[model samples]
Target: MEVVQVLHMNGGEGDFSYASNSLLQWKVISMTKPIVEEAINNLYCSSFPTSLTVADLGCSSGPNALMAVSELIKAVEIIRQKLKKKPIEYQVLLNDLPGNDFNTIFKSLPNFLKNLRREIGGDVGPCLFTGVPASFYGRLFPKKSVHFVHSSYSLHWLSKVPEGLEENKRNIYMTDNSPTSVVKAYYNQFQQDFSLFLKCRAQELVDGGCMILTLLGRRSQNPASKECSYIWELLGLALNDLVDQGIIEEEKLESFHIPKYMPSPTEIRIEVAKEGSFVIDSIRVSEVDWKVSNNNEVNKAKSVDESLKGSGYNVAKYMRAVAEPILISHFGEEIMDELFIRYREIIADRMAKETTQFFNVTVSLTKPK
Candidate 1:
């Protein structure tokens, strides 16, 4: 599948929209707030530009879209207040693939600005927001134009599905049973994509500029480890179930593969060294419970089984919001409801057997002067 054309989160304000199901992403942003704040402060102190340029690559639609940008503006404001510096202008760039729901973000822009102005009062400076619809795998900005960059819950997605996965049939991603060739193919693809990402960002960011990236990752170097690949494995099983029911062709299931890779910290460090553009300031690996976003529903449940069911449904919904578009692109929309229903059941059963969590790797990098 052409990931660039199909790899967008579920859009709109519906029950399954990314806007509604992105609490986990919000948790990621919150977890890395200190890293983002420190990076922005250091960048600002290095050379406080009267007009600053900031870009949030992969700033998918929803409340989380302007979230990091808002925090950044506040960080700059705090520093300015401390130094009694002159108010500054901000050129905020929200970038994502063309397939993303930029309209949702655009519509909410006015209210976002209004709230910011209200909070900052008369000290508020001009904050210009522009939506840049393009892939971040390549150049999206002019040279040395961006001062600060942030991306959350993105970058794990490869530019496209890796080639030579024909042997990876009956599975959508690297699984324990995947052949060594399939695992190697996925890793090779991630290396190439990540290197390109760093090179392009290096060109766009000015010297001393910094970036914070938070994405799905695994603790182990093993690409097929359960921590990173189990979610996709469950998805593959759901697809296979449909195939067994004859609702979807087995050939179609065999051909489909998610264009994503959850790299290990070792892999990330290696890729950064190979790219030779930016130096890693800090990197951390953290785990978030699978029910992180569904805690409220689970808490309200009257029984253990009900809580488990809620957690599973919550997870299934969020996963659907993120993965449904690509699935629909390849398998068609007719199978979505059924697929997720079975998926939720499978997830509930799995959670009953073991605790599940998503591993996240957040790294901060700086362009050396």
Candidate 2:
């Protein structure tokens, strides 16, 4: 199956489900709270409607899934109070690929709604939720429908692996030692994908509407920068270790490609300029620990094999939740637990000497009135 058919966060509320392992994404979104609020403020100043339309694109199923929406809702509630008038009724749309765990989200909907109503107070009007499963690179909403749009940690996923990536043998993503063709392929793919994203949102957003997007990005123009590509490079080493042990086929390693890319600020600016839909308000670049955390709790009663600790372990769980489906599709389901076990070990070892950090890019855009 194509990755589009298989790529999704681990479904259900199991131990490894995204709901169980999304602290990192939550942190990223939290860090962007002020940014999201800024967009909502702009929305209030511009549109100021009693009924509003909002969307969280790439709203994967998990604890972090509601992070963006909840924050936006709170902003909406606060705005209504500040205006000292009747509260607005909201239409909240959560969008992701069809393979996403919408079932889990819908099942948990009752509690989510209850919490919103309780926290936002009785003065607030109704808030309706809908799950929209489709590619954000294309039209997902009617033209000029959404008042404000938000997406966090989601734009990094390319619609598909770049063409000719089979030649990027021994690596699934761009690397320091990668050929020039490999570098160009990844960058070009990101350009096309992000351009289409802006174009679609341009159509969906009304005049003077706003968008706040936070995505993984490179601090350097070179896609081969250590901070940009080292995660997958280390992952490549782990896969080769599995091959060395004769546990997996080497051919399998060469054929697999990750359907993700982290674009640079330069690339993003070029795409936004070329697309010419939304004016670039500002781009705020931030840093996050690649390990997600420096500490993971340990339970004395748990066996060593049953428990893992520290940044590596937490980051491993986060990656596994979001990327496990692709791995299972490529390598089969049986190796998943073992594969993550190996990945965790590698991450832990690397953590001892270096700070594992990644740069994030948050761009604010406004559709012209």
User: Model 2, poorest ten-residue lDDT window?
Assistant: 299-308
Q: Which stretches of model 2 miss by more than 4 angstroms?
A: 293-309
Candidate 2 lDDT tens digits, 1-369: 375688788888887888888777788899999888878877885756878899999999877788788899898778778878677888988999999989888887889888878887757778888899988989999999899899998899999888877678778778877888988888788888998999899999888888998888877878888877777777778888888898889998988888888877777888999999988888988998775643346333255443334556777777788888888889998887788888988877777667778789999898989
Error of 1 at 243 (Å): 0.9
lDDT of each: 0.92, 0.83
Q: Which ten residues in a row have the lowest lDDT in candidate 1?
A: 116-125
lDDT string for model 1 (1-369, tens) is 788899899999999999999999999898899999999998888887898999999999999999999999998898888898899999999999999999999999889999988876658789999999988999999999999999998999999999989999799998998999999999899999999999999999999888899889999879899989998899899999999999999999999998889988899899999889999999999999998869576789999999999999999999999999999999999999999999999999999899899999999999999
Clashing pairs in 2: none
Alpha-carbon deviation at 19 in model 2, angstroms: 0.9
Distance (Å) between predicted and true CA of 306, model 2? 14
